[model samples]
Target chain A: MKLFTKYNRINLSVMAVVFVLSGIAYYLLISNLFIHELDESLNDYKDKLHVFIKQHNELPRFEFFEDIVVTYEPVNVALKKKFVLVSRFNAEEQKESTYRQLTFTEKIGDTYYAFNIAKPVEGTKTLTKTIAATTLVLLLAIVSGSVVLNRIILKKLWKPFYTTLEELGHFKLSRGYVPVFATAGIEEFSFLNRTLSGVMREANNDYRILKEFTENAAHELQTPLAIIRSKLDLVIQEEGLTDSQGLALKSAYTSINRLAKLNQSLLLLTKIENRQFAAVQAIDLEAALKEKLVQFEDFWNAKGITVTADLTATALKANTELVDILLNNMLANAALHTQQGGSVMIRLCPGMLRISNTAVSGSLDNTRLFHRFYKKAAHSQSNGLGLSIIKQICDVQGIGITYRFESGFHHFDLQWPV
Target chain B: MKLLIIEDEKDLSDSIRQYLALEQYTCEVAYEFESALDKICLNEYACIILDITLPNGSGLEILKELKRQGKEDGVLIVSARNSPDDKIVGLNLGADDYLSKPFHLPELGARVAAIIRRKSFSGQNQIVIDHLTLDIRDKTLKNNEEAVPLTRKEYELLLYFVSNKNRVVTKEAIVTHLWGDDVDMADNYDFIYSHIKNLRRKLAEAGCPEYIKAVYGMGYKFSIPS
Candidate 1:
C-alpha cells in the first residue's frame, strides 16, 4: 500500500511523541518489575545467607558483599556508586543486626581470614545489560507502530479530504460555474469547500453579468451612432456651403470622426474585457506584425516619424486581431509622444521582440500604466490608455512585458515562450 | 408604385421618402409601428420598407401579420444590425430583401423597385410580337414548343434586357442593375460582353428571332416590331 505524503512529515514528529509515551509506559512496567525482582531476590539471598552465617557463626565482609548487590542502572546515566548491604552481630543474644550499605568500608580486624558469605555483584552488569536491551526493544516497537499507524489509519481517515480535493481539482470556471463537490461529513472541510465553491460561483456570476452588459452596451450603441452619422451626412450634402461654412463643416466632420473613434475604442475595450481573445489559434506573428506595420507606414510618415523595423519569421499562438490592436496602440503612442524627427526602432530575436523609442523623458508616469480611463494632466492630446492596452494584451497572450527608462530610451521588451 | 417606410427617426424617413419621390416612386412614411400597422391594414401599398428593430415592437411582427394574411405585398427589412444571422432571420421570415444601416438612399430605391417588379410579375413575365416569348419564372425562352439552355449569367443578362425592353438601357444603368457592387471590382466590361453574346447565341439557336439589340458605346435592348 502506498502512503500519504502529508502525514509523513508530521508522523515522525507525532510518532516521536507517541513513541516516547509508549516507551515510557512500557519501560515503567518492565523496569519496575526487573528492579523489584532484583531487590526481592537480593533480600531473599541475604536472608538465606543470614541463616547460613548464623548457623556457622560468621559475617560477611564489606568488600566481598559487593557481589550480591542489586544491579540497576539506566543506560542514560552512569552508576555513581556501586554498593551492597552488609550485617554484623554485636552479641549472641542481641536480636537487632547492625547493617549498612557499604561500598568502600574496610574491615578493621579479620581473624582466621574468614568470611561466611560470598556476596558478589559481578553478574549485575549482565542483568543491567539485559534490562537495557528490553527497554530498547520496547522503544523500537513503539516507534515502528506509530509509523505504521500514521500510514494505515491516519491516511485512511483523510481519504474523504483527498477525494474532495480531487473533485475540486476537476472544477473550472469556463465550462460552467457549477461545482459538483458533495458535502463531506467533516464539518471543517465541508465548510471550507462549500465556502470556496460559493465564492467562485459569486465571482463567476459577476463576471458573466459584466460580460453581458458590455456586449449589450456595445451593440445597442451602434444604432444611435448610425442615426447620428446619417443625419450628419445630410447636413454635409446640403446646398450653399461657402468657405467659412465649409470650415464649420470640417469641424463637424472632425468631431464625428473623433466620436466614432471613441465609440470604436469603447467597443474594443468591452470586447477585450469579455475574453473574446481566449479562443486563439496559432498565428504567424511575423506576417501579422508586418501587415500592421505596413498599414501604419503612411500614417507615421505623415506624422514625420521614421519607423525602423526588423521583423523575423516567428509565430505565436494568440488572437491575431488583438495582437494587431496591441501593435497599433504601441506604435501610435510612440508616434504621438516622439518628436517629429524621433525614431521608433523595432527588433526581433529568437524568442523576444523589443520596441525602443525616444520619448519626452519623464513625461509618462510608470504607475498609471494599466489604469482604465486615466489621462495625463500634461499630455492631454492622446489617450493615456496605450500602455494599458499593451499590458492587457500581454496578460491575455501569456507574454512577458517590461517597461523601463533605460539609457534615455523608453524601452518595451515583449517576450513570449518558444 | 407606392411604398410606406416605417422608421422611428423622422429625418431619415423624410430623406428616404424625398429621394424615392424624386425617383418617381410614390412613397409615404410612418414614424411608429402602430401607425404603420394601421396604414398597412387600411391601405394598399406596392411595398413596405420596415425596420427590424422598432420602439414599440419589432417590425418583424408586422411582416409576420402581413405574411399570415396572405398579402403578396413585398417587404424590404432594414436594420442597424449588420450581422449575417440577422439578415438570414429577416429573409427567413418573408422579407424580400435586407439592407444594413447607413445605406445609400439610391440603393434603397433600387432594391425597392426591383422587389416590387418581382412581386408584381414573376421574372420577365411578358411576351412580345407573335414569335418571341419570355417565361421568366421558368427562366426559358420559347419560340413555339422548343426550349434552349442559357448559362447561369446569360439568363440574368437576358432578363435585364427584357425588363428594359424596347428602349436603350445605359451601360452605367446595366452595371448598376446587373453587377451592383461587383462592377467596381472588374477591370473592364468584357464579362458583360461575354454574357450578352452567350444569351444572343442561345436565343437565336432556339429558332427564336433575335430580340436583344445593342447600341454602340451604350447598353443593350430587347425589342420587337410594335
Candidate 2:
C-alpha cells in the first residue's frame, strides 16, 4: 500500500464510526424532546379541564378541539394523573395516529369521574428519519472528497521526496555521477537532500583516494623489481664456476619472475574492480577465441597436446581487451593442467561455451578453484590468479562461469546470455 | 651512438648505462630535471632515454621543451607507469617509443637501436653484420647475397641478437624479449631452446659462418671471432 492510502484509511474509518454513533444519539434525543413537549401540552389541557369542571360543575364538550381528545368515565375510586403513549383513531382523516395521552380522576360531587387528554405527535418520526438520512449523506461525501483530495494534493506535496529517491537510485560510484539535488521547499526534504549530498561527496572522495593508492603502489613496486630483474640478468650472464651456483641463480630468477607476474596480476585485478576499461563494442567472439588459441599453439605444441575447436560464428558485446584476457587465461589454465599428449576441446554454441581438457590428476579442488593464489599441488606454472581473473571478468560482464570434472575430463562452462 | 639517461632512480640508470655500454654506445646520465634540461640545451645526443617521473619536474615538460627547441633527438619513455593514458600522452608529445618498467635489457637495447636507426636517417635500409645482412625495412634476412627463409619469431630473435651482438643474452632474457611479459620464463624455456636450435640449423644450411655461439651454462653469445 502507498503511504498516503495507508494513513488516510485509518483516519477515515475512525471518523466513520464516530459520525454513526453521534448520529444515532442525535436522533434519539430529538425524538424524545418532541414526545416530551406533546406530553406537557396534554397535561396543561387536563389542568384546564379540571378548572373548567370546578367552575361549571360539568365536563366540557369534546367537539370544540382538534387533534386533542378529552374523555370522561365514572369510577368508584379516584386515581392520580399519568401520561402514556397510545395509538388513537382520527375521525377526520379516518386513520390511526400516535399520540401522548394524560389520564386522571376528578370528583365534582358524590360521583367520581376519570378524565383523559391526548395530543398527536407524528412529526417526531419524520424529523428523526430525515436527520438520519442527512447524516449518512454527509459522512459519505466527506470520505470520497478527502480520497480525491489526497490523491492530488499529497502527490504534489511529496514531489521532492520522490525526485530525490529517483536520483539516489541511479547514482553510480564508478562513473562518479553525483546527483545535484534541487532545493526542496519543505524543511524535512531539504534536510534529507543536504545530508545525502554530503555523504555522497565523502564516498566519492574516499573511492578516488583508494584507487590512486593502488595505482601508485603498483608503480612504486615495479621500479625496484625492475632493478632486481636487471641485476639478476647481469649476474646470471657472468662466467659460472660450479653447478650449484647456476641452479641457485636459476631458482632465484624464477622466483623473481613469479613475483613480477604476481604484482602485475594483482594490479590488473584492482584495475578491473575500479572499472578502468569501460569502452565496449561488438566483437566476434569466435574469431577472438580462435586467435587466442592460435597464439597458445606453440605452448601446447611443445607438450605434444592437440586442440579441437567447434566454434560457431557468434558475436557479443563487451570490452575487447577484457574478452581477450579472459580467453587467454582460460586457455592457458587448460593447457598448463593437461597431461602430455592430452587433447583440449572447445565447444561454442549460441548460448554456451565449454572448454574441456584431459587432467593429469583425478579432480581439482572445486571449492578453491576460483580463489586468488589457489593452485593444484602439481601445477607450478600458474601464478594461481588465472581463474580468479576469469571469475572477475564473468562478474563484470554478467556472464556465468562454472567448473566440473566428469568422465575423465575437466570441464569449464561459460554461459552467455541469450 | 650517443645517448642520455634522464632518470631518477640511480641503480636503474646505472644498470642501463652499463648494459648499453657493451653495445658501444656512449652514455651521459642526468638524475634530476634541471640537469636533464641543462644537458639537452647544451648537448646534441643521438637519443634520450626519458623517465616520466624525475626529481624536480615531470619528464613530459622536458619533452615539450625539446619539441619547442626543434631538437631531433629520439626520445624513448622508460617509466614505471603502465597506464594507456601515460603512453598516449607521451606519444602525442612526440616520443619515439614507450617501454614499461622491469624490462629486459636486451629488449631495451633493441628498442634503442631501432629508434636511433629510424631517427638518424642514415639513408641505408640494410644492416650488414658479417655476411648476414638484415633488410630492416623489409624484415628479411640475407646470408651471402642469398635469401634465408625465417618465421616471424625466429626472425625477431635473430634481429634482437644482432642488435645486441657480442653480448651474453640469457635464456630468461630471450624469453622475455621475444614473448612478452605475459609468458612465464621458467615454464617456456624449452620452446626458446628449440627455436634457437632451429635458427642455428637454418643459418648453417645457408652456408653462413656460426654467428650465434652458446656460452656454457650461461646464455647465447652472437659474435664472430675478431
Q: What is the TM-score of each candidate against the true structure?
A: 0.55, 0.77
Please give the DockQ score of every candidate, comma-separated.
0.07, 0.40
lDDT value, candidate 2, whole model: 0.84
**Where does the lowest 10-residue lDDT sum fall in candidate 2 chain A?**
A233-242
Per-candidate clash tally: 6, 0
- Candidate that scores best on DockQ: 2
Q: Give residue A335's lDDT in candidate 1 (0 to 100).
A: 61
Taking the tens digit of each residue's C-alpha lDDT, what string does model 1 give over A1-418? 3455655656666766765576557556665565556556555655654465567655444442354432221243222322344555423325434233322211223432212332322234455566567656766786678678877887776776787778778776544556667666778878877887788788778877876776677567666665655454444444445667656655564455344445555555655665665668887777777876765554456555688889888877788767867777776666666666778888876578888888666645668766766665544544455666678778768899887777667888889998
Model 1 chain A worst lDDT run, 10 consecutive residues? A105-114
**Clashes in model 2: which pairs?**
none
Per-candidate alpha-carbon RMSD to the true structure: 14.5, 5.4
